[model samples]
Target chain A: MQFCVIGLGRFGQALAVALANKGHEVLAIDRDEQRVQEIEDRVSQTFILDSTNEKAMKSLGLSEFDWVIIAMSSDLEASILTTMIVKDAGAKRVCAKAATDLHAKILKKLGIDKVVFPEHEMGVRLAEILSSPSIFQFLELAEDYSIAEISSPREFWDKTIRETDARKRYGINIIAIKRKEPYTDEKTGNIDYREELIMAPEPSQKILQGDILVVLGHNKNISKLEKATR
Target chain B: MKQEEIEHLLEEAKFYILNNRFEEAEKYLEKLLKEHPQNIEALFYMGLLNELLNRLTEAREYYEKVIELSPNHEGALEHLSRLQGK
Candidate 1:
């Protein structure tokens, strides 16, 4: 896949890096010379140019890219103008970042194919983290499914893996366990493990309170576990 | 004037308010008010928090304060009128 990412801010940088790491060709552009220099090696192409200028963007021939993502989170004008130019340049798909509902509506009216709200996404993730302190981490897989890392709760403390019917009762499958280790060598000259953790723990292992459990399941089941832990 | 800090807190409060986290939003706005006691935006938002929480007395007090501090605060006057059964 070929991707053109406008604005080299945090969201844009992350998207460009991830796509490029996944072997997709990514063209990253920003007006800031320093930011473009920072990602020069990571992406297939990095350019410094004002995206709001239609002629400047046209010079790059953005229409050749398979996906064009406008990631200016702060500058609504730049985001809107870039989206319009990308679409007018004949890009098949254009996704724009919107800071608010009004911006999303305007982008939609201007023919943007998709509107992304990073703040809303972060808010939802923060709410989930706040609701489940025992969860090491969580990701929204889809509308119904989720992937989460839940540490063994107090109620499940000292319980063997076989004792709890998490798979049947909660409808969650434990994919792996993350176990912690100290930094020091117990038998020889001191060499610390430095509180590092390991993943894909044995299935039959008893989960301790601190042991992080990686689970994949539906959102309802994930919420059930969260409520139970709470 | 530390306008940047004020704006940051206002943004945080707005986010919490939009998510229906009234208590958190109130905390943020209260801190912001302590820093800028005469801030019309903070006063107006404090009144909004009180109204959403159904604390009519506190809401009225904050709304009245906003009007007193800045008579031209359009939102505060509108909110105050709505709260006064007018």
Candidate 2:
């Protein structure tokens, strides 16, 4: 993957360096010569150029970049202009960090859909981790829907799918179940737990204690189920 | 094994694969195949398990077996393309 990041503010620099470290080709750019120089060794290339300048923008030939991120935190005009320049020059995907709601609205009006406020996403994820039980791993699919690996509900223990009839009662589907089995590592010769998955079990399949149910449905239904199990 | 029994085995194998429990997953899958040599679902999963464990050649063979049983298996075809670096 090819990534072009304009602005070497903390957020942009971290994003660019992380991408480069992941083995993706990154071209880090900033108007400040010192910022550009500091990142030259970490990324594939670093350049000092005024992104809004027509000749400089043209020289980037943005089509070569698969993803362009405008992370100009302090400078709104520069951030917005660089976003416009990159999109106009045909960068496949453009993401920009918005400092405020009005700035985000302007980016959307300019047809950039991948506008992000990093702190907001981090906050949501942190809340999710803090609230959910250690057993369940949740992935938010949308505002209302999510997929979670939750420990089997207490009421479900020793019950068959036919008896539980979860689909009708909970409005969620148990897509799979994970169970831990004792085993020895092939290389280490030490005892360890090996988890196994059961996909789409039959209606007659029984729910056992300590089983992790991979459930997919609306977030409300999942929360209800989690409360009942707890 | 009954259909329900086979399902339980596949489920266990898939769980192991998800948790990076390859050896245990392989044990269940191998036992599954030994009992029901022509189970296409189990065959497909073995391929997936191998793919995740970075056993490319073994994964390819397992996927090919699934294709042999069910020629139009979309998962197998897609995985084969990835294995061959298409």
Candidate 3:
């Protein structure tokens, strides 16, 4: 995949480097020469040019990349203008970072393929994690539904899926189980651990102590299930 | 079943659903629908049950049936819209 990241701020730099590390061709652009120099070795290409310059942007053939991310939320005018230039150049996909609700509205009105509010999303994720102690991870699918990895409740220990009756009792479906098993190293005479994942575990499969359950359900029901841990 | 018996069965299903005994609710709803196939309440509850169980296709089918039987059914309309991502 080819990705172009504009405005080499902290977020853009991180995104570009990560994409490049993932074996994608990443082109990073910024007005600051230092920023370009900082990441020149990390990405496929680095350019120091004002993104608001339509001619310079068009010369790069923005449409050639699979995705172009405009990461300059701090400078609203430059961000908006760059987005327009990128869109006008027929970029296949455009994602922009929005600093505020009004900025997001404008980005949406401009027909941006995707708009992200990094700070707001991060805050919401942190809040969800803080409130759910039993939840190891959570991915919100909709306003009310989510998929979560939660510690197996005490009541569920040693019980088979049929016996636990999770779907009936909590209105949640356990999709997978993650467990860590101890093993002795044959040559070193030392104990080690290996992680195992059981996908779509059978109804007769038992929930063991220290097992993590990957479940999907409504948020309210998930909270109810989490409370069962106490 | 008699009217009183049907009402009692519906109440039982509703009770089970509210208490998070979805399997028991499904059993009772199945029994009710077996006798009264076109019961709107039974179909709607079945749809809700299937949705909670992650049987998306079955849920959509049940909700569609409910809408077909009664186009102005508000509950069915709302759930169907959500299921269809409308």
- What residue runs in model 1 are displaced by over 4 Å at the alpha carbon? A17-24, A33-42, A105-114, A154-163, A181-184, A188-209, A218-220, B1-86
Candidate 3 segments whose C-alpha is farther than 4 A from its true place? A182-194, B1-86
Spell out the clash pairs found in candidate 1: A183-A192, A183-A193, A183-A194, A184-A192
Q: Across residues A53-102, which tens digit of lDDT does each residue of candidate 3 receive? A: 99999999898999999998999999999999999999999999999999
What lDDT does the true structure give each of the candidates?
A: 0.77, 0.79, 0.85
Error of 2 at A187 (Å): 15
Candidate 2 lDDT for residue A81: 83
Query: How well is each residue in B1-86 modelled by candidate 2, as lDDT tens digits?
Result: 89898889988887776655665788998999998988987788788766544455678999899899999987788778877941
lDDT: worst 10-residue window of model 1 chain A: A188-197
Taking the tens digit of each residue's C-alpha lDDT, what string does model 2 give over A1-230? 99999889888899999999999999998889998888889999888988888678878878888888888856898888888788888888888889887888999998885888766666665566458653246777777898887767768877997799888899888889886554545674322345688999888888765577888999889888878766
**Distance (Å) between predicted and true CA of A196, model 1?**
9.6
lDDT of 1 by residue, A39-58 (tens): 99999999899998889888
TM-score of each: 0.57, 0.58, 0.66
